[model samples]
Target: MESDEIVRKFYDETVDDEWERLERHRVEFELTKRYLNRYIKPGDKVLDLGGGPGRYSLYLAELGCDVTLADLSEKNIEFALKKANEQGLAIKRLQVDARELSTIEDSQFDYVLCMGPMYHLKSEEDRAKTIRECLKKLKPNGIMFVAFISSYSFVWDYLIRNPELILDSERKSELNKIVDGKDFAGKGFSDNFYISPENVLPFFNQFDLEKLHLLNSESFLYLREPELLRQKPEVINAWLDLAEQVCEREDLLSMAEHIMYIGKKPIKT
Candidate 1:
């Protein structure tokens, strides 16, 4: 599946108009909010790359930040525009490829979020370009929030769930192929690269890593028994507290579904 098609399917089947509002109250939303709060402040100029349904962008706008919501899907842009208009909030929407970001001005935003682009980019060069363009758009000392699929999730998803597939050497061997700098599972559009926590630092070193926070966005909650976990509010809160501690530890960071890196652009010469 091409990434665009996958994203279309995602919106069509997995999400609806209420996705934006509902997702904000989820456990992962709380984690993202706490981490992102460190970078964003009132009156900041913010750009949300791949702003699906404009949830985070809307939050930023409400916080008094001037926000630009950019995505590759026209449908998403239209949806965002409709919602923005309804709230009487001023938000700029643009349809853009994450790899080619010429539409946005350089050094113009105080904060840039390259959230979903990295996951769908099947090529390291494309990933690098996405990061570089994000860097170019940031003012000196600007912050960027990036998300990546973590490798450990694949181990659990592929190795644990379907052991028979991995047990067959021929079948498992085929899974290791890397094409155009993307792993076999990452070959298709919807399937993007999953990097280990160890690989992240070197990749970000090409720019500058100001703060790195690994987020177990969907993992902890999804792993638990739904009924029991949902009924006990204290357990969920404790789980989050533990997850936060886990994110800070070197060994456990890779166990996350997605890891976020909050990076900085150097002071311009």
Candidate 2:
């Protein structure tokens, strides 16, 4: 797989709409927050890498966690800062790539959120570099939330949104490529790729961290945000409760559009 240099430009162009993503797909944000609340205490230092437009970073900041938000897109960093100020939240900001965060020292943060980098990192070497760098920034026993846009989720997206493309010979061939472990031709999201659910946990095993949870972020709720918004709060809460109950089920991992792999760094021997 190869990378296209569209990450910064694509995110920069869409920075304004970034926060609205959470607004639309409320489950991803809510579940991730629930996990964060369990682990992140007040004054805990956090690194929100590829944390576009300050959604998670701002949430952490508002919780009194010292959040340092970083991203490859300058426009995203600027937007995140502007919103943080609007929310009266204090967030340290940096415009940097996940693969090379040299300015951030090793073992500095209690929590690290590598939220968006995996979606665009095509080369396996780059993916390894990014995770290695991010984990190195985490304090011993600190938590990390590494997210990905699931490859199986993308297949659902095609079935739900663009069914016609699924049957077309040329498009079918391309989709097959992705199913067979290749990157997608970035559609609405420019230069995107997906990782299989089966690969996620094992991918992190190579790191010096104890595996904790692999959450299927929007289980069976993939591309159903519009319907979710129409539900009563109690109804939505009920479904969310069920989602939480079943999120860790390996069978349901691919049903989610987004998934987060949580792990804790080991205390040095």
Candidate 3:
């Protein structure tokens, strides 16, 4: 399905403008930043693999982390550079595919953030390669963060918001495949794949990584559109707190639109 080209076109065309506008996306950014803050210290080296438009890269750099942002789209990389310059931050920007990071040295970064690549690599092998590349760049005992789209959330969204789109038998079949941890590459919906907690956890277990946390990036909060738009500041804070409290419940993780896996490389014995 030429998934690489599809991913390139999708991000190059819309990622910069589309994500920041959503309330869900705002929550994702804030939560991710908060989580990263707990692990990153001043002068630490961070590799932001597949970081779209350097949003996190710039934030990390501002916090005194030496950051390098790598993305598949040249357009994204260029935009990130301009953004870094405007903020008076120094960040290394590179255009490279996640599956192949030969230019990056092994065990070089104190932390690796693969925030956007896992969902786009449609095949299991490619997804594994991307993970290995990210781990290869992490120093022993360094932390890594990976994000994925949730199949349960995708199915729930269709049932609640877009049932009409899946009324067709073919579309319904594709949805079933997605639930089974398979992606429909030529479906023309979005190019990215989806994963369930069952499939994701086992995949990471194959690596020499110590599990830290599996969090729902945007939990039930994303489903509550009316409350998100109309609630008072205090109410919103309470909702966010609730979301964080339940983000790690395995029974509820699949309900999140996006899931995050935080792990660390084991130090060599």
lDDT of each: 0.71, 0.83, 0.82
The alpha-carbon deviation from the true structure for residue 199 of candidate 1, after best TM-score superposition, in angstroms, is 0.9
| Local distance difference test, candidate 2 | 0.83
TM-score against truth, every candidate: 0.80, 0.93, 0.90
Question: Which parts of model 1 have CA positions greater than 4 angstroms off?
Answer: 1-25, 158-189, 208-222, 225-229, 232-235
> What C-alpha lDDT does candidate 1 achieve relative to the native structure?
0.71
Sorted on TM-score, highest at the top, how do the candidates line up?
Answer: 2, 3, 1
Candidate 1 has which clashing residue pairs, if any? 3-189
Cα lDDT of model 3 by residue, 78-140, tens digit: 888898899999999888999999999999999999988876777888999999999899999
* Per-model C-alpha RMSD: 4.1, 2.2, 2.2
Which candidate number would show the highest TM-score if scored against the true structure?
2
- Assess the local accuracy of residue 93 in candidate 1 as a C-alpha lDDT between 0 and 100: 88
The better-scoring model by TM-score among 1 and 2 is 2
Tens-place lDDT digits, model 2, residues 1-269? 23435778888889878879899779888888888888998999999999988899998899899999999888988998898888898999998888998999899999999989988887778889999998889999988899988876657767877888877886577568655764443543777767777788778878888888988988666567678879999998888877788888988986878889899988987
Q: Give the lDDT ranking, best first.
A: 2, 3, 1
